[model samples]
Target: DAGITQSPRHKVTETGTPVTLRCHQTENHRYMYWYRQDPGHGLRLIHYSYGVKDTDKGEVSDGYSVSRSKTEDFLLTLESATSSQTSVYFCAITWDRGTGELFFGEGSRLTVL
Candidate 1:
């Protein structure tokens, strides 16, 4: 275990609402990532951070945003909730970006109705 934690393991909200999720780690890894798991898309990256205040958008980052103010904390926010955005989100950490050995936290499931 890399001391990763995700808040609000499960959540339900109405469409058009705003939702935020938090991911915290104690490992001090250099890279942190947010991903959404869907049936057909598998695990799609939403955002990632390589260092404090250094972040970037990923393949499926249209309605999502991420912030990394510290090396151990990464936050993900959904600007406006949508039924299509309902999915299980996962937070992952990796020390070596080239090796791609990611340690994942328990997923956070979000539902929009």
Candidate 2:
């Protein structure tokens, strides 16, 4: 977890509320990714944005959306929070995929009742 910071380190919410997690990186890595860590899934990609205003959905994209208006900022929003979505989320940034070095932010832990 270097050069990246995620806000709201911990959160507790109801079943239908909206949730947004912010990731800020100082390294200016063009490739930014959002991932969630679960009990058995390890780390799964939720969404990733490679450049400003350009994004792509990942395997577990349902009920999730992302926006990247600036190089240093990435936002992940859950349209409607659900209990199944409760997990620790991480934001990763890498200078290049070839580098094979990705830096992640301190995870954001979310719990939905």
Candidate 3:
């Protein structure tokens, strides 16, 4: 509640266009993640960074990519947006690794037509 923000909260794009969503956090947490929430699949991770410059692909990373150049910012880019990629994106940060509980940003809604 104190340290999270997402950009482009709502967007509509054409298929094959490039799009990028930004997540900003002031918590200075070590773990940050990008996830997509769909009707049936629920929340699935697209990518995550444990620390600055340390990133890894997640379960749904096929159509997405991410980068973390600084401690406070993480970016998710859809190189080529597709209709199937339409969904709500969420960013989360964790202060402790053991609990696995994350504080989430409101969300970024993207619709690909």
Q: Estimate the Cα RMSD of every predicted model relative to the unseen true structure.
A: 1.2, 1.3, 1.1
Which predicted model would earn the best TM-score?
3
Task: Write one digit per residue (lDDT tens) for candidate 1, span 35-104.
Answer: 9999988999999998999999999999999998888899999989999999999999986555888889
Candidate 3 global TM-score: 0.95
Per-residue accuracy of model 3 over 8-104 as CA lDDT, tens digit each: 9999999999999999998788899999999989899999999899999999899888999999999999999999999999999988545888889
**Any runs in candidate 2 off by more than 4 Å, and if so which?**
none
**Model 3 alpha-carbon miss at residue 36, Å:** 0.4
Q: For model 3, what is the C-alpha lDDT against the true structure? A: 0.93
lDDT by residue for model 2 (4-30), tens? 989889999999999999999887788
1 against 2, candidate with superior lDDT: 1
Sequence-dependent TM-score of model 2: 0.94
Looking at model 2, residue 76 earns an lDDT score of 97
- Which window of ten consecutive residues has the lowest lDDT sum in model 2? 94-103
Kindly indicate the candidate among 2 and 3 with the higher lDDT. 3
Global lDDT scores for all candidate models: 0.93, 0.92, 0.93
